[model samples]
Target: MYNNASVNKVFLMGYVAREPRIHNSKNGKPQLSFSLTTTESIKTQGGDIQHSEVHAIKINADAACLKDVNLKKGDMLYVQGRLQTHAFVDEQLIKRYKTEIVAIGVELFDPIQL
Candidate 1:
């Protein structure tokens, strides 16, 4: 093990916190927003347990990629993207910052069977 270059990339696997929000930008690019919950492995003398955290993500796709496929709420998806931080001023004129996963690729997983 060694401490080296700054590590900023992450590969995440989790369940969707909510339904995907599909929208179009003013320039007509297809975009979506959703949250994912990921679990971490917890270990101790007793055994192992999984801890989870919910993350917010944004997915941007080309118009052609969004055709015919109907994405709905509560859909299971896999997202590969980069970590991004957004800083903005709210209505109160106070500066605010938030971090989110900006997706470059999205894949839908099979639905959960009953």
Candidate 2:
């Protein structure tokens, strides 16, 4: 028996829901976080249905990547990264879990016309 499989990648293309929240990490690394919304329509027994999914993205990149690009709400983007899950305890001492896309690359598209 032979096993050879290794892949951890995610690709998403969607519109930015809001402006990115920029901040610095403890080690002084630049970080950008934003919400992306992807929508799709599916055929079901009832009828055609529209569905939308929002993904939280966090980008840890160099200063150039975060400073040179002007990111804004409603901007279309293509992101490639890996999925990451974080577990922490809230103020109430309850455990919480969150899944987010840790973006390695981001490409900004032209503004979407309505």
Q: What is the C-alpha RMSD of each candidate to the true structure, in Å?
A: 4.6, 2.6
Instruction: Put down candidate 1 lDDT per residue, 2-106, tens digits, no spaces.
Output: 677565665676678787777885577777777888778999899998888888887675534455656665666666778989899999999999899877666
- Candidate 1: clashing pairs of residues: none
Top-scoring candidate (TM-score): 2
Where is model 1 poorest over a 10-residue stretch in terms of lDDT?
A: 61-70
Q: Write the per-residue lDDT of candidate 2 for residues 1-114, one digit (tens) a residue.
A: 448877889999899998899788668887889999998999999999999999999998564445578888898989898998989999999999999999988888775542
Report how far off residue 13 is in candidate 1 (Å).
Answer: 2.0
- In model 2, the clashing pairs are none
lDDT to native, each model: 0.74, 0.86
